[model samples]
Target: MPRPQKVRKILCPPAMSGFSPYGIPATDSEPIIMTFEEFESIKLVNYEKMPQEEAALLMQISRPTFTRIYNRALNIIGIAFVEARSIQIEGGNCEFEREWFRCTRCFKLIEGLENHSKCTDCPHFEKNELTRLNPDIKDRIA
Candidate 1:
């Protein structure tokens, strides 16, 4: 049997779940699924202007693997743009370094529950509006 895949280390979750082209209905086309690792690869290399070798080290993956992931992310985004399809970020063999939460009202990412507070900028904000992004990885393993 093939060896099990290593879980990639993601620094944090994406602020938003997905994206779609303006003036196009989401139902018009099937969404492209971009994994968390793929997103990280793009963020590290493209967004952060990080070198491939350094980004690989940050993700605890090899440079070659990081390249492949980054390429895939670019392809997905290109297709999404050309086809006017939504890009959904989810589902990867990855583990986050910390718990993350999002304020539904303003879509602000919070590091942890202890740090979660009402989003002052959001009207009608409530503590209960904070949504946890990552479930405990240990729980999934067990």
Candidate 2:
């Protein structure tokens, strides 16, 4: 049996879901769907100027896997531009790397979205202080 896919972690999702080419009529053909992970790979490797190795580590995926994702993203983007087709960024096995805090009282981890100020199971549920979690890939481009 094939190995299960690892859930990629993205810091934040793209603001826009897709882009349509200007001066082109909407076509019946389906838009090229770019997975969130693919988008992330492009952003990290291209925009963020992160090395493939560190980007892969930040994504919690292997270097080769990250390379494949990056290549696929570039290919799809090129096709979208050449064909003047829309590009939709969505649909991937991913999870947002949201801030998590461990409760001091119960030692239970809580997500940032939940109302964690007051906990019934514990005496108090102060939210965990925010800290930089993602690897610093600024100069580690090896």
Candidate 3:
């Protein structure tokens, strides 16, 4: 059986959100949902200055795939920044890790520090059990 494709992490804390200074507005009529995974690809390859092969491995994707994702991310972010339009993060092919929690009720995937031991999204989950499971978490410059 083929292994699952690991989705790269893209939820950058607001402080680290990659908003290019030269991003231009996207004029494409069909809207695209930019996944966080794609964002991480750009950060790893461009921002962190990692080699394409290394970045691809870190993100658990093939080098070509990583290149595609990174380019797409850069394109979207560039347009948003240049056009001054708000970028909305949405759906992608990925999964959350064990430490991460995606609230069933709210459908919010909370990414908190490991020390917190609780999701920032719905911290008061006394009724909802926090299942210990691993999800794909892409790293960024913290």
Winning candidate number (lDDT):
1
Candidate 1 segments exceeding 4 Å error: 116-128, 139-142
Residue-wise C-alpha lDDT for candidate 2, range 19-111, written one tens digit per residue: 788888878447999987899999998999999999999989899989998999999999999988899877676666774344455545455
Report the lDDT of model 1 for residue 66: 84
**How many times do residue backbones clash in model 1?**
0
List candidate 2 segments past 4 Å from native: 99-142
lDDT of 1 by residue, 1-142 (tens): 5665666889999988889899997788999999989998999888999999999999898888888889999999999988899999887878888877788878888886577766666878888998877634553431
TM-score of predicted structure 2: 0.67
**lDDT tens digits, residue span 55-90, model 3:** 877766788988888889888877765656656554
Clashing pairs in 2: none
For residue 59, give model 3's deviation from the true position in Å: 1.6
Candidate that beats the other on lDDT, 1 or 2, i.e. the better one: 1
Instruction: Give per-model TM-scores.
Output: 0.82, 0.67, 0.52
Poorest 10 consecutive residues by lDDT, candidate 2: 129-138
